[model samples]
Target: MDTDRLPGCYRHPDRDTGIRCARCERPICPECMISASVGFQCPECVRDGSGTGHAPAANVPRTVAGGVVPADPHLVTKILVGINAAVFLLGLVAPAVVVRLELLGRYVEYFGGPVEGVSTGQYYRLLSSVFLHVEWWHIGGNMLALWVIGGPLEAALGRVRYLAVYVLSGLGGSALVYLLTAPNTPTLGASGAIFGLLGATVVLVRRLRYEMRPVITMVVLMLVLTFVPFGGSLSVSWQAHIGGLVTGLLVGLGMVGPAAGRTRALVQWGTCAAAFLLAAAVVLVRTAELT
Candidate 1:
């Protein structure tokens, strides 16, 4: 406590003149001093504490103008798009690739047709369908939609939750097809999941009391067009769209409203898990019928 009688610096005992490290309060010479906002500190104290003076600006989590901590980059979305692109490229290399990867409801033992006509092991098609595209243009359209809708949604939901929304939504779409559509028909692309996210966005925007009329109008228009039956060549599965959207709305019930602290996450994840399980059960029951 004596200003003038403080002991000499531990490291440089001969040079101390009573100035001390603000953090450790150890005597320090000018040589060991590093100026902080509050007072001078020693190098060891800097290393043991903030070390903030030399930290990069980019290391901080930045907040937006509205006092919102900007969410991390949508890495999951990008990874998804990349995977789709890779699969598309592989299909390009081998033309027969489509026949192997596209979703079909029937079970197959090998390169041949279904074994005894029952849906046994081909449940993977429900998932594989989300990544397959019949044409380069098909992938182009789906990927564009993904980029537009996915980034913001992933940012809002975070990586794991966003992935859950996307994958489960896709499976929900295929579940409808499995129950309602013919077993031989092959359906492919990401439209179902995209529609699901769009539907969830509408619900979330409304729940948050944001201006959502525009989003609602857009989704309605798309759904209407999906069923227009223009020349019957588009072969767009309105079933998938409806299924995904309904699932998205169901999942959003737990996610979009006022923050429930840990309860919010628990409910949101519970809703997601229930939706997935229900879809799986539907597929299982239908498969039993086929077998």
Candidate 2:
């Protein structure tokens, strides 16, 4: 080995291209290069950069491995927020449009409803309802909560895992509403996912034995506002809140627990999967009982 010779490609030692990574300045070949704003980066740099808060230049998007999908930190959270915002904008354009998007308890009512009634074939409401909000304040509150929790949790759990937790939480909440709420009542919101994030955060803190009183306090306050009537005729859906919170807790314990090592990882994901299956079972059992 020549002491002064610049290193060859880390991956392809046989081929000494002498190309340096833009971020880490490690020797790389064209095959190992990931294009960046300033210069080509090595695979490790690309992978590490995507997980960090640092981003590529405004004009250039960073991609991993094959240069196909752009690698982004907290990308899922941003997309989720954008979807909710776009749907809300559409609602502003037309009231009827928004009504159709909301989740009605009647569709789950296999038994009966008024023939030729408002209950339509919106089987997708179970998932779609998570994105629809009628009021600016409603969307605003939920989005704010998402913004608060999304970044860190998404970064920690990775995009797909975070999305799984969020979607399942919302779906669980909707199922709970179908089972518990009046058939004629309509409901929709991302509170269930938001609550799930909160629960995940709590789990993360609890496992680390970190101070989590604020989380507990916030959960308590929200519950109080949910169940206790406000301003005389104010109608709040405590059932959904409770459902979301419980689902989030189970998710937190399962997906974001403090346990360590390979065994912990297996248990964590298994727990998350079971939580989802439990929610699905609830829907099936409730539907069967009603039918």
Q: Candidate 2: list runs displaced more than 4 Å.
A: 1-72, 107-122, 258-260
lDDT of 1 at 19: 57
Provide C-alpha RMSD values for all models, in order: 15.7, 12.2
TM-score attained by model 2: 0.68
Error of 2 at 5 (Å): 50
Error of 1 at 213 (Å): 1.3
TM-score on alpha carbons, each prediction: 0.71, 0.68
**Number of the top-ranking candidate, with lDDT as the measure:** 1
**Model 1 deviation from native, Cα RMSD in Å:** 15.7
Clashes of each: 0, 0
lDDT of each: 0.70, 0.69
How would you encode candidate 2's per-residue C-alpha lDDT over 1-291 as one tens digit per residue? Answer: 677554678898874554577677878754565656445677777666753346533223222211233356578999999999999998888766655667775543322533211124345777788899888788998898898877766655666667777887887787788778766678888887788787777775565344467778977887788878878856666667777778877877776443334465577578778887887777776666555
